[model samples]
Target: MKTRQFFASLAAASILLAVPAFAADSAQAFVDKAAIGGKFEVDSSQIALGKVQDQSIKDFAQMMIRDHGAANAKLATVAGEQKLKVPSALDAQHQGDLDKLKNAQAPIDPAYVDMQRKAHADAVKLFETYASGGDNAGLKTFAQQTVDTLKTHQQMIEKIAAGQDAITGATTPAVKTDNTPNAAALVPGANSFTEAQAKSRIEGAGYTNVSKLTKDDQGIWRGHATKAGEGLAVGLDYQGNVVAASK
Candidate 1:
């Protein structure tokens, strides 16, 4: 009788220990999702390295390639130790995102920024969930260590998208300041902002309906924008100064 009761209790304990193994995000699920997300970062950034014109976006793409490439390798190593499979390519959904980058609707910079925003948000959530409640000890540790890097990336991209994009925490204004009384005098220098970035900068300065943006010789982006229910000419300098256009 005593032996039977002991065996019963032991079985119950074993069952309790096995419950976490069937967690919502299983070990292999983490491996798959992480692999897919990492692949997307590497592949999309690879495309950006070749096609993107924005210097900030270009620098970010380079970082994604270097960082995600290393993370992928480390994940593969960990997955191998756990006898899990690492996917070599992006999943169907991520492949679609990559396709958009490959053949974007023009001004691929915005597309890339949009894609990274979504991707890093997903990655940060995934890593946070797994870090705290994952089935595998190794993956949980990896997720914990990686979550901070992903969050930093998220902040960086937000700054870039917001047009406050100098990695060094500063942007130079164009030689031509916007809102000068003489629209023709808007000085141009070297405008590196894509249309999307220029629009974002203008919008960030509280303008709306920015349209017909064109870069002139002084590296100034001149466009029609509305402020306070007033339609006026707006311009952005290389340094990101947005001012009303002289009528």
Candidate 2:
């Protein structure tokens, strides 16, 4: 009777141990999927850099590359500490998306913008779920922090999509013909410029009241500026192009 009781107690302890192990396995699965998603965003955006002709689309793609690349690096470090393995390649679904982007025969800007909208929407959902109740404590915190950035990206992409739709419907050329040089050409390799340096460059270009300077996910410096007493929204792209849109 004593031996039988002892064996029963040991089996109960073993089951108790198995429970946490199962939870850890679940956490590992989330980590893997999250990592893959980040990689997909970075890779797809890189492809857009070469294929997109629209400056706005290119700017959006640059932001994806910068933001996703940073997030992926942080995630890799977190996963490493927990002994979870992250896959370097995209899964089948993401690969399919990439293929479509590469082979798109339609105007590339709309196609790319549409894809970004869908992708970010799904990403926001995924991060929200994991952040709210995932088993991994460390990764849960990471997810919560990252959800804000994901939402921001979503909002930006939505605006881009709407603007692109309007541009597509218009009959006139997107920009009037002028002798002005491309603003992007002025600062070659502008991505390397610090925020202060970028601000100086904007000021040098005859913009005043430069305030609310913030770097968006695409490594662009955006803020409010005034040229001849008119308020304007302006952005400096990674390649040093100063793009201004009238308010």
Candidate 3:
């Protein structure tokens, strides 16, 4: 009995020691993949800004550049603190995505929008998985916070795709616009507050539980807020406008 109990204790000790190693590995893998994805988004969007004739597509590409660039910076800081080595170059798969975007034929708006939708959809899944069950605590928090931003990007890209389909009479499924109170459109450039200022403004506007706030290049701040026991998609634009959309 003593021998069996001793062996069981040893096994438990081994498992305990292995947990951090597994977490570190998970964190490293996440950082590597996220770095590559951010680079791909920014680079491809830059290309699209120059190539796509559609104004809305240009706007979406600019938003991607700004948002992904900020996210990459944050991830880099976290990776450095965690002693993880994030890859400096795109992986082969992401490289192929970039190549595809660059070589896509005329009417590049639709193709570009399609790619953005798919990429963002994948990104949402990746972030959601990490947020829910990742071994690393800090990165898990980061993932959880970032998931909202990725979801917003996905929704915007889907809207663009649907609009494009409408214009071209394509059979692509149309996104139904919700008429709920939280479904208000973002008024870009409607506010001039920096992110910090936007937070203050949001608090002043009687929003509680404000978090996950992010500001795009157009000075639009997006995240969650609550008022009257209802969740809202709240934003402050560059033109100093504060607006809330129903969730």
Each prediction's RMSD to truth? 9.1, 11.0, 15.1
lDDT of 3: 0.75
124-218 in candidate 2: lDDT tens per residue? Answer: 99889989988888889989989999999998888666545533333121222453322342233336556775676566455788888887665
Model 1: per-residue Cα lDDT over 1-247, one tens digit each: 9999999999999999888666534888999999999999999999998877666778899999999999999999998988888988788899998998888754477789889999999999999999988878888898988899999999988867666433112222222344553333234678777889788766655677989998887788888877777677777766555657433
Please give the CA lDDT of all the candidate structures: 0.78, 0.74, 0.75
- Candidate 1 displacement at residue 105 in angstroms: 5.4
Tell me the lDDT of model 3 at 75: 88
Of 2 and 3, the candidate ranking higher by TM-score: 3
Over 4 Å off, model 1: 1-25, 164-241, 244-247
- The total number of steric clashes, by the backbone 3 Å criterion, in model 3 comes to 11
List model 3 lDDT by residue over 136-185, tens digit each.
77788889989999999998888666545533431111223352322134
lDDT: worst 10-residue window of model 2: 167-176
Comparing 1 and 2 on TM-score, the stronger one = 1
